[model samples]
Target chain A: DAPLFDRVAFIGIGLIGSSLARAVAHHNLARSTVCTAKDPEHLEVAHGLKLTTDTAPTIAEAVRDADLVVVCVPVGAYAEVAEQLKGNLKPGVILSDVGSTKTSTVRDLAPILPEGAHLVPGHPIAGTEHSGPAAGFAELFIDRWCILTPPPGTDPAAVEKVAALWRAIGSWIEVMEPEHHDKVLGITSHLPHLIAYTIVGTATDLEEDLKQEVIKFSASGFRDFTRIAASDPVMWRDVFLNNREAVLEIMQRFTEDLTALQRAIRRGEAETLEALFTRTRAIRRAIIDAKQA
Target chain B: DAPLFDRVAFIGIGLIGSSLARAVAHHNLARSTVCTAKDPEHLEVAHGLKLTTDTAPTIAEAVRDADLVVVCVPVGAYAEVAEQLKGNLKPGVILSDVGSTKTSTVRDLAPILPEGAHLVPGHPIAGTEHSGPAAGFAELFIDRWCILTPPPGTDPAAVEKVAALWRAIGSWIEVMEPEHHDKVLGITSHLPHLIAYTIVGTATDLEEDLKQEVIKFSASGFRDFTRIAASDPVMWRDVFLNNREAVLEIMQRFTEDLTALQRAIRRGEAETLEALFTRTRAIRRAIIDAKQA
Candidate 1:
């Protein structure tokens, strides 16, 4: 395969960041890869794992001469990263990201883009419940959809280049509007995580022995939620914080729908419950048909 | 290990039933094992898989001459299963079940149990998302929990016999009141499944392109819900129908809590959202510590 980028710099070496770094390194998608995280320990792990060709000590140093600088940090840190990278990026460099929400990302990072540099915000719709550099694998993004919501009038060549990089890592790329991406992901990713967090929280408040029983019997259904709820607290905290409006808007619809079902359940409305369940099975079937199951 | 019973009969040979049959067959927990399902195809699979020593087509034929009979059908099928087995069961037979709900088990099965027949209800809280006899494995219950909700004045020997069988299959047993068992499972099992079904159902209502995208991008978080929602619809339909009150009650709490978080997200109440996400993380830890993760 042709090298997709001359060099790629990773701004934060956590799960998604590390996964991208690993994929870029493993598949030789880039001629060389370098990464830097805010935490020294994480950088040390990147060094130990040989996650990239170089582990830079600071974000600016990492982006200094790279053709592609992918911001892989929490969205909450977008401004800090953008501020730090504003001056050091090479001319014609491409700035992209794997943050969950795109609108907030553009709001925070676009104004700071250096002249002649291109900004393309992307979200690779892939992750495991596990986090951190070690948790990353080359296949994490394989066959997954990566949404790139570049602002209109952005250089087509830059968008193509970034799209080429993710495609090299085995993702199908689609261009979407920033607002639409947020609204859609707010329903699919953000709301699901929020529900998992809340239900697990409800389980936590149970009496001690009952709580143990909940854990013991978790395989019935709660195990899935625990795995999800175990995801990096800081990162998810940033997600729910940064994607506030869109997340909340969709969440409103979700709650209202949930309440109607709840009332039906309370009234022993088996038909209502069964109808919903049967409809969901069709979605699962669609996922299987899409081969993303 | 001591053999727990002279003969064990299983009514309704689906995933959970076939798994218990496999466990019994593997561990030599009973002198003989027999199973039957209302669906002939499932019974044929049970026989073809050799999940039991004997297979019958009727619930009455299944329990006749047996010392122990476990009802492994859907909870909604309990009344009919109990009614069918009422006159056909041998004297002193132990009638138990592996239903998700407990209160309804007693309400449906207890009265129909014949004199000298012991009713020691049970729920071996282990399963996979898959269904049917072919999907079962002997290790399904290993290191999982088995909760027995024997009503007051229920025969202790019958309860012990069931517990011993589960123990031989590598389960830790908990004896609790039927109502308490239902409540804990309402949070852990029933509510989780309902939410999974609901969210997956919500995504099912999306526009064609968006729905396709939701499935293609499911790995973001929606994939887990798909797996859960892919679970046997009929089994789940019965679970919700039979466990109506407990599931609805807990679902009410879940929706209210979800609403508050939705409000936080809409209002951009970062603190409220972060705090709950943080608190939920602690529960995931507790579950992991309990070795349920």
Candidate 2:
């Protein structure tokens, strides 16, 4: 069968980008694919793995004749990348992304988009602590949710095209308003990553002896935080910076709740602790019932 | 071959208790085993699973004439259970426990220990979020750390016997001072559980719409915290209450660190965020190297 797009250009080939590239190739979602990265080593690794039909040395070169351009760089780097893609994108090209924060994606890429071009920003809610091109897999998005937040007035056909590609690659697509997307992910994704990074950072500052023992006995619970903290630093840093408002709001609630629990522990209020814990278990059950656990 | 212990009694056949009983039977570590629980349903489950040779209705009946008695109840119930075991233990009986807080174990079990009996408190660094007798398996302790915190001046023979039984069940034994064990676990286990429970509780308090969205997108990061938070509520409540000082101290350190990171995010201190994230990654590597991940 003919491919979905004549050509697909990936502006950055990291974990999510590389995974999508692999999936597109495996599922024949695109006729041909090309990827570019600021890091020359990543480009070489992408070439080594045959991640795409071609490797481009720059964003301009990658998106030169492509019908679709997916911005896969860190959110913090979007402005710089958008600057490069301003005059290079093909006419009527559909631009999309695989970023964690949607509001930031639109804020960064919308202004640079050409008049006839379509912008469909997507956030695939899936990943591991590992990063880089080699860390990606073709099945990473299988059965995962991929949310698209297109600015109002976007072409339905363009939005549907992007959704169809993700669906072909094995993702369940959900369309949401950008602001609501950021707020929901602030609690579900951003806040959890922040807390994990902070707790793991706390252990990093412990005295040498205690730190060693902490790692030795990490299987109990701390190991989970370490794994989350091990995710790409630049990607996460960009996420926090871009979603500051929503993240800070949820974090404020988290801190207040933590303080209450701390007080209960200090005062030996066993019932309060048990009550909150039991209530939280219901959330776990809900996640399981939703088949998201 | 003769069994390591002629008779072993299990006080409170819950998750840890039943696992130990199953391991004892599987490894032939004891010739005969008896278990008792304050919850009659738990006793019935123990009998149905054949977790022990016999199920006794009370602690006194369970420990009567047993050569070894392993306390597997929650830390909060230790003192009361100790009261019941005061005169029921056989002479030369080696008393042990599998509780989270080491200092509290020594404080509660040592006073009621028989004149010739030994007290060796243990905490196995392993478990799933599930609880109850049916949730346990014989291999729960395999390749896991079983920390034994015997009070100073405890009988050497008794300590060795307890250590040997754990070893026979495929556990690596680590001897530690009661105070030190609590301090180490305060950071590794208690503090993480508190953070998880707090974060999940925070989401539990969100508005109805957002709360459902949180569960739906939980696989991004929130699901992990949910699993940890889903752990037995009564058990964790007792943990925080019994390990108050150590938990509070570590929590103070964690809160201060979190506050600094929060400040950095507010100020858009990208360098600060990136540096801490990179450092935390090293700890994850160390854990992987230690084979703990």
Candidate 3:
């Protein structure tokens, strides 16, 4: 594989950031790599892990003279990142992001980007329940999907370079509108996490005796939701906050559907319950057949 | 390990049944083992895998001379299984079941059991998502809890024998009243699966275009719920049907709590949402500390 960039800078080195940093280093995607994270301990761990060739104390310092700049921070941090990278980015530098939401990212970062710096919003639909720099690995993106949402009329070469880098890291690429991507992910990802967090939260509020039993016997099914809910709370809070409209819209639909289900269970409508239960099994089969299982 | 039973017969050969069969076989807990299933194909698979020493053509044949009989079919078939085993079971045979719910099992089979035979209802709190004879592994029960609910003032030797059998199969045993076990499991297992099945079903009803996208991007969180919802429907149907009171009771609490959370989200009550989410995370940490993670 050829080096995609002579120099690349990372704005935040969290789970996704560190993972991509490791992947870039492993694949030699860039000749020189640098990163800056807000948290001091995280930066220390990233340095210790050798996530990039150099660690910068400031975002502007990190992007100086870099041919590529990747903003791998929480969606809420996009404006701050773009502010720091404003005049420091090299001419013709491709500015990209690995955020969970895209519309807000484009809206937040595009305004602050300097002339000759390209903006390409992206989301790698891969993550574990864990977070932090030390929890990352090069294989995190293997066989996963990386979606790019490039504004129309954006330079095609900049898009291709990012796509190629992701492909080299074992991801398949798709270009889509930011709005469509958010809506699609709202139902598949956002709503599910909200529900898991809600149900597990419900169990937590149970009477003390029942609560103890819930943990003791969690292996049944509740435990899986707990694992998902155990994911980094601040990161998730940022996700829900940045993608508010889409997440709220899908959460509405989920609540209505859940209400219907609750009524069915209350009414002992076994047929409706079983029919829905049986139909959903086919999707799991489809997922297995699609090799995503 | 000492032989726990003179003879033991498994009535169905699937993931749970075959795992128990393998454990019993590996540990020499039973001198002879036999199995039969409603589906002839499963029998063929069991026979091909050599799951039991004698693969009987009928349930009656399998239990005719056995010292212990375990009904391993999906809970929906419990009544039929009890009917079949009633007349054929030996006078002193200890009859038990490996089901998700105990209250209903006692209700369905206790009345049908022969007058002199001992009933020591048991449930091994262990399993993987996979099913079928091929999915069976001998170590599935290791370090897991197995709950037994024997009726008031039944034979102590019968309960001890069943506990010994589970111990031989590498499970820690606990004895509880039927109602308490039902209530505890309702909060732990049944409610979680029901919620998972409902949410995954909710996603399946999305528009065709969005449905495909849901599957494509499911790695976020929905995928876990799908896997849990894909579990055997018949077995779950029986679980709900059998543990109706406790399941319904806890489900009421869950629905109410869910409604509260939904209201909180809609009202943008971030503090409430964050607090509940934080508490749940603490519970997750507890589970990890307990070595159940």
Candidate 4:
């Protein structure tokens, strides 16, 4: 069978990008794949690992003739990358992304896209605490959700083709409005990372001796949060900045709930604390039952 | 090669208690072990698993003529258990516990101990989210820290024997003041669990449709918090109530830090968020370096 696309270009080859490249090559989804990153070392790593057929130092060089261009950088850098991509994209190129925040993806990339080029923003709900090109694997997207938020009246054929790319890489496809995607992920992914970052930052601010002891005894429960908190700082920062309203709304609810629990603990309200804690366990069971645990 | 104690009694055989019992049996740490729980089903499960040499109906019966008595109930139940144990402990018997909060262990158990009996409170820094006797295994304590918080002037021989028992079960031992133990754990274990419980509780409060979606996409980061939140509720409620002071202190620090991050996010202060997140990574690296990750 013919490959899904003749050529695919990745604008920033980090964890998700490199992983997608690996999967693309493994599945023969593209006949030729090229990637570019601002960091020379990351490009070198991608080249050494053969994550792409060719590597370029600039997005212009990478996407000049590519049929598909997937932007895989921090949301904060999207605008700049979009500028570089504006004049370089081939007519009828399908532009997609693997960024965390989708509304911002549309807000930043859609304006600069060339006429006749389709914009289909996406987010793959998969990754580990580790980052960088070397941390990628061909199976990274297996059984994970890859959400695409295409603007209204966009070409269905273009969306289907993008969905096919993710499908070829083993992702279950979901198409949603960009705004709803941001809201759902605000609760699922963004808020959780924010809380993990806050708790790990709290541990970091402890006195020197106590800080060392925390690391020594981290396996208790803190270790999990530490792993979540160790995710790319720049990536997370951009996520918060780009998705401020949704993140803040969810965070406010979380803070209020936390405050109520704090008061219950202070008042020795065992039943109240027990009720909330017990109810939360049901969700965990549901997650396990859903095969997402 | 002989057992450390002639007879060991467990006042409540839940997850931690049963795991210790299994480790003791596997290593022959005790010549005879007897357990009793307020819940008869737990006793039945313990018996079915052959976790102890004997099962008794009451604390009085369980502790009779035992050389070592370990209280393994919720921290909130410590005072009631102490009242029941007031006259049951034999002379020169070593009294201990595996409670999360050490200061409360001493405050509750010390007042009721008979003369010449020793008290050594310990907290093993290991456990999964699951609870109950069925969730225990002998390898639970391997390579983990078993912190002992014995009061001043306590019998050195009793402390040495308890440490030996843990050592035999492959635990590394660290002796410290109970207050200090609570403080360190307030940061490392309690706060993390509290945060996890809070965030998962927030998810539980969401609209039904959104809640289901959150679980489906949880692997993005929320799944980790759900696992922590799934931990036994009564045990955690008791932990927060008993360790109120230390937990509140650390939680206050955490809230301030969280609020700062929240403000930064609200203001779109990318640098502030990035700086704190990057600093937290150092702790994760340290935890990995310490072999506790």
Per-residue lDDT tens digits for candidate 1, residues B1-293, read 55678889999888888889888888888888899988788788789889999998888788887898999888888888777987898998888889988898999998887788888889888888888888888998888889899989987888888888899899989999998888888878889988888788777776888777677677778888888988877778777777777787787777677777667766777677677777777777777788777
Q: Per-prediction DockQ scores?
A: 0.66, 0.89, 0.62, 0.88
Model 3 chain A: ten consecutive residues of lowest lDDT: A234-243
Clashes found in each candidate (C-alpha, N, C closer than 3 A): 0, 0, 0, 0
Arrange candidates by TM-score, descending. Answer: 2, 4, 3, 1
- Candidate 3 chain B has its poorest 10 consecutive residues by lDDT at B261-270
Task: Tell me each candidate's TM-score.
Answer: 0.95, 0.99, 0.95, 0.98
Clashing residue pairs, backbone N/CA/C < 3 A, model 2:
none
| DockQ, candidate 3, vs. native dimer | 0.62
The alpha-carbon deviation from the true structure for residue A208 of candidate 2, after best TM-score superposition, in angstroms, is 0.8
* Order of quality (lDDT): 2, 4, 1, 3
Model 3 TM-score on a 0 to 1 scale: 0.95
Q: Which residue segments of model 4 deviate by more than 4 Å?
A: none
User: Counting only residues 3 or more apart in sequence or on different chains, how many pairs clash (N, Cα, C under 3 Å) in candidate 2?
Assistant: 0
Candidate 2 lDDT over B224-259, as tens digits, reads 999999999999999999999999999999999989
| Comparison by DockQ, 1 against 2, better one | 2
Tell me the TM-score of model 1. 0.95
Stretches of model 2 off by over 4 angstroms after superposition: none
Q: Looking at every candidate separately, what fraction of the true A–B Cα contacts under 8 Å does it contain?
A: 0.70, 0.85, 0.57, 0.88
- With a 3 Å backbone cut-off (N, CA, C), the pairs that clash in candidate 4 are none
lDDT of 3 by residue, B93-182 (tens): 899989888887788888877877888998888887778889999999988889999998779999998998898778888899989999
